[model samples]
Target: MPAPRILGAAAVLVLSAVILSACAGTPEEAAPEVTGNAQTPTAAAPEPTATPEPEPASTEKPTCETIISESVVADFESLGWSAQESPLYIGSTEITDGLQCMWADFEGPAGDHGQMYGWAPVTEAEATDAQDELIAQGWQREEDAAGVYITESAETVIAPDAEGYGITYLFGEGDVKVADTKQNLLLIEWPKS
Candidate 1:
């Protein structure tokens, strides 16, 4: 996978974990497909049990503008970045009613001048776990007069809890914020250029 895809996958996993945590009941797992013949060459045959097919994935897609506010886009713009509507998707799974935006200086180096932001529903534990996972994955955690921060490199400062988490990767740094209800996660990433 490309670098962006990997980061997207991580974000997706964290989002999925948090959403899973918030659910009152777990979803049913799909049964394995049975491929072999039901009867043997010389044995008396018994009736085989039928297995139900898995449910189809939902076709819903979120209107991102509803989840990502104009003010938030302005915030990035204030920092000299241009907002780009980046839709988030992972194979067949995707976030409906979620936020996916990217900000960048198009003139900068190939992998050095942009940021990405994402938001999705999540539980408190899920949000916390996502923060911990980012730190564990080589991003350093720090606290200062300004606020808490996490960074993948010295030049980047990933702001913490701008309201979830602040995390940055090789390309840029960003933050994550969770709503008070513990039902949403906002992820921000600003790549270096």
Candidate 2:
């Protein structure tokens, strides 16, 4: 039995020696030799190209004059205003060298409220003719420092309308103020001073 024990110990010692011998080697063989130049890092897929920014859209509002002119004409025509008569004619004139007159009128409750507008380049005779026509139609001259004449009258028998015609005369330069009425609608006189 003692002899068998000795043999077992010897076998264990031999196996351990062989394992240690196999593991013992030069540093180059033990760890893989690193080349002088390190491996090039894979270029990060060329950083995905940045998408270009979109251009800004144009932002601009239409001119005020254009809007005003179009709106006035459209409103006047839509209201069934006749332009053939003395007080209802639609006309444009040069008030001054660079100014212009844009005027229009419609049949009023009394008769016709004649209006004259624009840069006022026309002679005083023309202005008087315009005023006279309105005066003949029972439109009273309005006292305004801004050179605007207004005439207002009420007629309940003509139509079941509540409001009557309000004629306004605009001249000089700038936007014209139009009077709104149920029967006559709107009359505008734009004068380019």
Candidate 3:
């Protein structure tokens, strides 16, 4: 009987609390407000700029005609200097594993005056040794650049006359450019050793 009375008291207290809470004032609605200044854009955005590309390095192996200008070849041909067959030489010294392009002034006396252009897998020491050998063999030493060696001839086929010059431009890739100018020939690149 006491438990039933306590249960009834508890139910009455809960009902009273619910009625009081419902009678309480409802909360006012509050809208979200901007925290900072806001505006529409006045102008269009700028387009991004393009960067320029760099030139690619040359990797193509050189050919006899491609090594030198075609105009120069034509000019030499215009003269009596016609391309001759090769056992590639830099004043009678045979070169190996490279290209050779020669031209001789056959119309000249005894077919003497001519030019040679060659590149070979010759070491720097080998080129220097060849220069030394040429100097030893009476070839007039003209210019001696760091890697290039120039020698004039008194009797060598590179320059059988006093007017000619023998030149070697070492490209330091294990090759040397063996060239001369009496009639007219030139070499520019060499193979790597």
Candidate 4:
């Protein structure tokens, strides 16, 4: 081959070799090291936990009166009152303390007025709260009564029949406390004329 051509070919070959060598080798790449002066990303702060509201006190067991015993009915009769064998449900709410009720009425001359007996397996706090509510609503607590806390108003009377028994009595329109328990609430309502 001619000298110029040989020189030109040699130059071309050398350029191609240089380009291949450069492409064949990979450059080392790594994340840059953080220095003391460099600002490192901080972890985000944890969210605040929320506190839950407390639930109201309630009776632990159901206290519904599905059936009123014959003796109980007779007791009403002895008391000069006529009671329904079946329970009648009044409205329910959170503050009732789990009470279910049934009604009894004066059979003869006092027919216009009646009594309501209810029951609930409630916590002590619940029962006390109910009694407190009645007194707060103008129900005068009965004086010197053992085994029961009775209260009276101008047209109503209410009592918790024996502590821890979960039984209550409401007469006339004065009863403001409601029943609360897991059991059905036994309630009675009699309006005054």
Best by lDDT: 3
Model 4 ranges with Cα > 4 A deviation:
1-69, 74-99, 103-115, 142-145, 155-193
Ranking by lDDT: 3, 1, 4, 2
* TM per prediction: 0.30, 0.29, 0.45, 0.30
- Candidate with more favorable, higher TM-score: 2 or 3: 3
For candidate 3, the 10 contiguous residues with the lowest summed lDDT are 184-193
Q: Cα miss at 138, model 3 (Å)?
A: 1.5
lDDT of all predictions:
0.47, 0.43, 0.59, 0.44
Quick one: best TM-score, which candidate? Answer: 3
> How good is model 3 by TM-score?
0.45
Q: Show pairs that collide, candidate 3.
A: 173-192, 173-193, 174-192, 174-193
Question: How many backbone clashes does every candidate have?
Answer: 18, 8, 4, 23
Report the lDDT tens digits of candidate 3 across residue range 123-186. 7776777777767767655443334555555455443334544443333446666566522323
lDDT for residue 176 in candidate 4, whole number 0-100: 29
After best superposition, candidate 3 residue 25: deviation in angstroms?
59
Give the per-residue lDDT of model 2 (tens digit) for 130-174.
557656766656554666554444432232235444444443333
